[model samples]
Target: MQVAPRRTGEWWISPAIPAVANAALASLWAFTAFGGWGEQAFCGVDSAHDPTCATGFENAVLSSLAVVIPAVVIMVSALVLRRVRHYPDRLGMMLTAAAFLWVGAEGIVFLGGYLAQPS
Candidate 1:
């Protein structure tokens, strides 16, 4: 028995599509963070009436981690897709892309709301 050749299109489909999709998501994140959307306060009183307060140092560290963790996952997945030969990479790529977009959107919404709040 002989192994069949992988389709030419498969080479382009798995890695290329996800790369473009994730890049777009990254750009959106940049825009949200720096496009005069709002100042992102990682640690502060959520509201005047709130009984709890987040220490600035702790919030900053945790918030940074929240962003970093997903970013690391995205980067790792992209690297994996580049080297994977036998498995279909589409599912992993799509899932990572979705996560990228979701995180970006959450950041945008969080900052947008913060800016919208009345001073």
Candidate 2:
């Protein structure tokens, strides 16, 4: 008979669930965020003719800020909370930090694309 591992006291919940869910969400965001999907969706294919459409520069800046700011906040939170009383769910915290790092990477790529765009 196969034996199951003993359950630990504090962290009964598995970290993989949230980690996978977040990963999936991040991927969806990446798929939609790049290639001017937001602008196209909001202003249609001919965004230039749409008076309501924000400039590409504006969209890029806002997108960068949106991800980067949250990434900073999540990173800060993970570091700050890590110093407190020994946390049981270290794996969960690490996964959270990893997710934000992914976001930070996306933000960097977005910034690069933004800079490359013609004014």
The candidate maximizing lDDT is 2
lDDT of all predictions: 0.48, 0.54
Q: Candidate 2: RMSD over Cα atoms? A: 8.8
Relative to the unseen true structure, what is the C-alpha lDDT of residue 76 in candidate 1, on a scale of 0 to 100?
60
Model 2 — which ten-residue stretch has the worst lDDT? 1-10
The TM-score that candidate 1 achieves is 0.43
TM-score of 2: 0.44
lDDT for position 12 in model 2: 52
Clashing pairs in 1: none
TM-score (all chains, Cα) for each model: 0.43, 0.44
lDDT for model 1: 0.48
Question: What is candidate 2's lDDT per residue for 3-119, written digit by digit as tens?
Answer: 234475432545555467456746655664655554444445553545334365346545565565565565446446645214536755665765766666566545644453444
Give each prediction's root-mean-square deviation over alpha carbons: 8.9, 8.8
Error of 2 at 65 (Å): 4.0
